[model samples]
Structure formats: C-alpha cells, structure tokens
Target: MESRELAYFVAVAEELHFGRAAERLGIAQPPLSRAIQRLERRLGVTLLDRANRRIVLTAAGEVLLSEGRKALTALRSAELRARRAGRADPRLVVVMKPGGDAGLLERVLARYAEHPDAMEVEVMICGIGEQEGLLRDGHADLAMLRIPHDDPTGFATEELLTEREVVVLRRDHPLAGRTSVRMADLAGENFPRWSEECPASGQVVRDTGQVAQMIALGQAIAVLPESVTLTLRRDLAVVPVIDGNLTTLLLAWSEESRSRPLAAFVRTAAEVAAQARPAEIGA
Candidate 1:
C-alpha cells in the first residue's frame, strides 16, 4: 500500500489506541480510524482486534507493522542518499556516544586520512542507544557501538575490540578497594539508569557523565566497559567486574551504504583495530 497508509498502520499498531495515535500524527481520531478501516478493506483482512476497552494487532497487522518499519527506513535512506549526492564535497558522518569508541577513534581517523580518496569525516556524539537509529535513518553513514548496549541488527558491522567490564563506585564505598568483584557483590547497590526508553534497574541518570557524577556523590554506581574508566574523575574507583558481560566494540554501517569513502573508512578501522593493543585501546 501507500507510505501514508503504512505510516497510519504503524502509528496505530504502536499506540494501540486511535485517539493517542491520531494525537501523535497531529490529526483527529475519526480520520485516523477511517484510514485504518480503508487499509483493512484494501487488504481484505482484519488488521486489528477491537473489543471493549482493548485493542491488539491481528496476525496480519503484526506482519505489516514489521515490514512497514523496514519500508519506511528504506525510503528515508533513499531520500538522504539522494540529497547527499548533490553536495559539492561528500563527507561520511560517523555517530557515536562521547568517548564510546574504545581508543580506536583517533587512530582510525588518522589512518583513513592517509588515503587519497578519503572524504571529510564528521563525528556526531549522540546519546546512549541512539547510534543505531542514526545509522538506520541515514543521519549517519557509520557508527561505533558496543554490544548489549547497542543492537546492530539490519546493519553490517566490523568488530573492533572487546574489553572487560568495570564497575565505577565512589572511593569510600565498601567495594571500591577490591581488585575485582562479581556482579552479585553489587546486586543491591544503586545502578544509575541511562535511558527511559530502555529502562535498567536502579536509580536513573541521563548519560555516563551523569552516572559518574552520581557515583562521585555516592548516589549510584555504574557497570561499563573498561574503556570508560579512562575518563572517570579521581574521586571514582573502578573495579573489574569479573563475571560481567564483556563489551564488544563494533563499527556499524547500513547495508545499503555503498559510498567509496565509507568503504575505505571501514577498512581503515579494521586495520587499526587489528594492530592496536587491548590495554592501550581501553586505556
């Protein structure tokens, strides 16, 4: 069907309420309801299961919701690529969280610069869990992401480095002096939550910097990749979390990206990762 129909279906499927979906789409409930009815009629299937005070997607609706999202992503990517093609000097936009690239970002940039055909590189530091969305929607040509923290599905990724996890705590905390600790040791401690969209247990904070501040004030602790320890303030103590999941760093790009500069940058990143020492990279 049309993009607008897909958009309407997606909105209603996600919200499960016509009034709420209409509000989100900046329209009134009746028109939104009509659009869904029209879509169902065209497809000759019941898309939604409607009952007293309840709404749920039918099997058909589920399929449309999944495929519609992919279609929208593809459409957006096409528009962005077309717009970028008209620019005088093409640049590859790389998105990542601040200080999230292990220690390979600078080395990768320097190595890529040596290539005569390399395009200008623009680094966009974004919030936690935002890298994937940026790359998917064509806001970025590439992104540096860590496993478990960022999902890399639907994109091609190159593994850069893997590092041990560390827990950042206040210097005066009971577990601060330990050489290493297990996850169970900090079970009851306050862990600062990063994003409301993906809620984690314990107290909530905006970003790692805020997590650090909270730790310094004895408000909360954080379990993060070892690389993050390099930026921690002196008042914080970092202890290895022996049983925590290892964080794997990856360079991710949309499967649709075919730019020569983008390909060159990916090659440089892999080469740099291969030669770099894990300790030096994490430090």
Candidate 2:
C-alpha cells in the first residue's frame, strides 16, 4: 500500500472519526474517507467497522495501524540518516542519559579513537527513557541504552556492561551511613517517579538532576544505576539496594545501519566494556 493511504488509514483509525482525521491531515473529509476505502479494497481487508454511528478498528485495522506507524518511522529515519551521511563532515551521533553510561563511555570513546575507521563521535545527552526515541527517529546513530536485550525494542544491540542499582537520598537521612539497604527499608521513602506512568505520590521528574534536586529538599529519594553516583552531589548519599534491578548497558544502533564507522565504534565499545571491571560501590 502507498504510504499516503497508510497514513490516511492510521489517522482515521486513531481519531476513530474521518472528519477529525481529515482536519488533522489538513484535507477534506470526503477525500480522506475515499482514501481509506481505497486502501481497504486494495488490501482486501475490512480495516474499520462503522456501527451505530461510531467507528471501531477491526483486528486487521489494529495490526495495520501498528505496522503503519513503524513503516512511517522507518521512512523518516532513513531520510534523516541519509541527510547526515551526505554532509561534508563525517560523524556519528550517540545518545545516552547523562551519567547513565556505566562509566564505560569515556573508556569506549578513548579506545575507539585509536581505531582506523573512527570518526567524530558526537554525544547527545538526554533524559532517561529518551535514548530509544532518539535512536528510532534517526536523531542519533548509536546509544548507550540500559536495556537487557540484544534486539528488544526494534534496535540491534550489543551487551556492554552490567551493574547493580542503588538508592540515593540526602546525606542527613537516618540510613545514609548504611552500606546497604533493602526494599523494606525504603518502604516509607518518597522516591521520585521518573515518568507519569509510575504509580508514585509525587509529580513526575524527567532526569537525575530533577531527582537530585528533590532529594536535597527531602521531597524524594531515588533508585538509580550505581554509575550515577559519580555525578551526584556531595550532599547526597548512596546505599546499595538489595532488591534493585540489574541495569545492563547496551550499545544500540539501527538494525539497518551498516556504516563502517558505526560498526567500529560498537566493536570498540564491546571490547572495552568486556575488559573493564565493574565499578565498586564505596561506603
């Protein structure tokens, strides 16, 4: 199917109303309706069900919507990646959460620079959970992502580092001196919720800086990757949380990317991460 038809179908499916979808698409309702009908006929599938004056997506419609979004994203990403490749200055863009690199970014870059295929590596520091989007949309060529899969979330990844997480709170907190704490000990603590989906008491915070600010004000405590401790303020204290999750650092890039510079960087990162010892948690 044409990308335009897929886009029309997606808009209609999401809005559940052709009129609204047409308005969103800056087109007339009649044309939008015809486009979707044409797409359905071409695909030989009933993509939408109109019953009792309301629109609902059929199973096939749902699948198309999901797949269509992916196709659109892929197209856009290809455009961006191609544009970057055509630039006079050859470079690679790598995205990551600030202070979330498991202490491997510096060492990785240093080692990768010695490689013959190395190019200028531009680091795009972002908030948590944002590296995925940057990579998906081709705003970045690589990322130091903290996910445990080799190919989860549609990106090809190589395992880089694995380390435990810890809780950070104000230094004046009663349990700050403890070398280790448990989930039970943090039961009553006001941990900052990094995203809106978290079922926590306080307003959502977007990054470590925000979490650190809240912790300093005694408004929040946070469980974070131990690598972040190096970036934390002196007033903040860390205690290893026994039940915290193990964050695995991965070198993530597009599955379709075959750039030699990108490949060399990934290989260099994997080698460095494999040889580097895990950072110790100090009391």
Candidate 3:
C-alpha cells in the first residue's frame, strides 16, 4: 500500500525472522511486526505463518515479495535513464541549399569535433525555401544562405563572407581557357543542368539568375559557388564572372540561439570560407 509497508514486507520475507528482519531494517521487532501487519491488512491477505519458535512465508507473501522487488528494480532503472537524458549534449541542426564543397563540409565537421560539448548534428540539405521553412518552424537551428530570409521578424542574419560566383563550363567551351569571364559573355549558351542526379547542378539552378538546364546545353553558362565548382567536376572549368563576381553568403538563425554554439560554428565557418576562396577561383 505504501513504500514503507512494501519495504517492511520484503525485509521480513528475506530474513524470515522478526528479530533479524527488524535488525536489518534498523527498527525494533514490535514496530517491524506492526508495519508488516498493516501491509497485509491493506492487501487483505495473510503473509506469514508464525509460531513462537519460527516464521515462514505463506503463498501470498512469496508472491508479493517477488513482484515488489521487481517494481523497485524498475523504479531505479527509470531514475537512471532520466538522469542520463538530463546530462546529454545539445544537438545542432544545420540547414543549407543542397550541394556543398567537400572541403568546406570537412572543415565544418572538423570545427564541431573540437568542441567539448558537441552533440550529434543533423545536416539537412534542401532548397533555400526549405531551409528558411525549417528555421522558421524550429526544425533547423542554423542555416547557410545566399540571401537570408526576410519574413521572420525575430530572425537575424550575419554576413559570413562575400565570395565570387564562378562560371562552370565544360573544359572545351571557348571561354573556359580565360582567367575570367563576365556574366554577359555567356548570354545564350546552354550550361549545366540540375537534377537529383547532379546536386552541384541543382545549387547552380537555385542560386543563379539564369536557367540551369539551358546552361548545360551550352546555350548559356551556369554560375555556381566557387567552392562547388572547385570540388565537383574536373572536366568543368570554373572562372570568375568579372562584374558578376560576388555573392554574399550568410549564417542565419533565430535571435534566441544566436549566442549559442550555433553562433560559434558560424564564426568557425567564416574562417574556412576565406581560406578556401582563393584556391577555388582563378587557378
């Protein structure tokens, strides 16, 4: 009926003698006997068979003893699990438009590795619209973006870096040999196409003003992250589009978590982006 009653029942059940059970429980024999009597009264069952010289369990006492021990064990296990959950690390979610440079991805992962309090991170690669939706809905803690969302009144964006957009053309294309090409030069060439099959191409579609598939057909040129072009296809030549040279990449989040580890990650990422910029564009 109560924890104390169950404890008294168990103590007497195990020791099988009133004097010894009371000693184990740190109580006098008469009080221990009274507690067990109270438990049997609540359960409406006889628990022990007692004579002047000896004590033994009735069938009912044996049954209650088995179940009470099991219940105590389960209670302890649940407490331990709850404590573990309380101490677990926080998870960081990163959302971005699909297609990332492999080296940049590696660098981001490395920075997270250095944090002592890091938890498991879930990386969600989606279109800009989806990334914005996740941040607004609380599904993502942070996002990397070409342009930060403007609708959410509580959100804030930090400009991480402004890096040049590059033209990715098949190696044999005429302007591919040039050190740089302006956006206007490739007005009608069908450039790289975006499909689930080509993630790098998909990002080119989402970020640039031009149609990506039309660019792939060589009637236009595709513009993409200098990082994407640098890491993806060896046969594609990436050249900065002179006047078209830059895109402002930002790290965005809700104002509440802006001071947390998510912000720390944003700072680390800016360093990686600046270091990776030069090797990615001209040579």
- Encode model 3's per-residue lDDT on 1-283: one tens digit a residue: 7767887888889999888889998999998988888888888989998866678888998998998875654455455434533555646778876553223656766876687645566688775346666665556777766642223445677665566678777677888899988777877655544444553333334533234334445555577666565445555567887877466666678664534566667767777766765455323
Clashes of 3: 17
Among the numbered candidates, top lDDT falls to: 1
**Per-residue lDDT over 173-227 for candidate 1, one digit per residue giving the tens place of the 0 to 100 score:** 9999999999999878877777765465666565677777788888888888888
TM-score of 1: 0.90
- Return the TM-score for each candidate structure: 0.90, 0.94, 0.53
Model 3 TM-score is 0.53
Instruction: Write the residue-wise lDDT of candidate 2 on 1-283 in tens digits.
Output: 8888888888998999989999999999998988888888888999999989999999999999999999988988999989998999968999988676777788888888999999999999998788888899889999877754223478888987788889998999998999899888988778777678888777787677888899999998888877777678999999998888888888888888889999999999888777876664221
After aligning candidate 2 to the native by TM-score, how far in Å is the CA of 145 from where it should be?
Answer: 1.1
Quantify all predictions' global Cα lDDT against the true fold: 0.87, 0.85, 0.66
Model 1: how far is 128 from its true place, Å? Answer: 0.8
RMSD of 3: 20.0
| Model 2 / residue 186 / CA error / Å | 0.6
